[model samples]
Target: QASLADLDILRRTRRMEYFRIVNWDNMLYPQYEDKMQKTIAPDIWKWLQSEAKRKLAEKPVAHPAVRAHWQSIVDGIVPFGYNVVEE
Candidate 1:
């Protein structure tokens, strides 16, 4: 069956992981080569920044399932130098 639901998984998953990690900077990836006076389409990078901020603002502290998923994200981001809040 064809559906729009299954579509964009690649983009969605990619953005999800990117959001979990708060290191959105051109110094990190070449995706952002221009800024200020000039720029290109900022879809993925923008999605990450906006989505990350929107989510973390809620501070989801309930739901073990959500926590477990966030745990994996935290572990994955460890190499990037961002610390996760533990309680």
Candidate 2:
């Protein structure tokens, strides 16, 4: 159950990771560069800056499951260097 839930969230947010990686000026795989740049990169710069900050500000709540999931979400964006509250 936990694995499925984690995979689902990863599936949803995988594009965000790609955007971060691409913006890092790294050489992304040639196959994905065209589509990622032409299509996804168009609006991702603006959205990623805002949404990534918002996600980092999110705090885990009282419920264990919710906290765990929230941590997973937070972990995905940790590389982007948002100012997360240290727990």
Candidate 3:
């Protein structure tokens, strides 16, 4: 996961918190301590993001300051999925 704290665009972004869901029914996520299992699900995540986007769009004003910042830095994001490294 990446943090936007240092990004210039996010300076205007609100201090809002959001959530995401990972369907761990199949063990998709890295095994966490037993106490946190079943706490990840995709449906829950989509709902939260949907609400955020809806709230942002409902207001007829400039984006939530952080939106532009996220768009501005989209290309700089690098995926770290595991892959073979050739010598």
Model 1 segments more than 4 A misplaced: 1-41, 60-87
Clashing pairs in 3: 13-66, 21-41, 22-41
The 0-to-1 C-alpha lDDT of every candidate, in the order given, reads: 0.43, 0.48, 0.43
Candidate 1 at residue 86, lDDT?
26
lDDT of 3 by residue, 1-87 (tens): 245543433444644354323445646445554434334344444444565456555654656565643333343321233222222
Q: What TM-score number comes out for model 3? A: 0.29
Shift in Å, residue 35, candidate 2: 4.1
Q: Taking the tens digit of each residue's C-alpha lDDT, what string does model 2 give over 3-73? A: 66776677687743432323433345675554343333324444544554465466434467655544554
Consecutive 10-residue window with the lowest summed lDDT within model 1: 33-42
- Residue pairs in steric clash, candidate 2? none
lDDT by residue for model 1 over 1-87, one digit each (tens)? Answer: 343334456448655443222235655666554322122234543444454445555667657665554555443433134333321
lDDT of 1 at 16: 42
TM-score of each: 0.26, 0.24, 0.29
Quantify how close model 3 is to the true structure by its C-alpha RMSD in Å: 14.5
Q: Least lDDT summed over 10 consecutive residues: which range in candidate 3?
A: 78-87
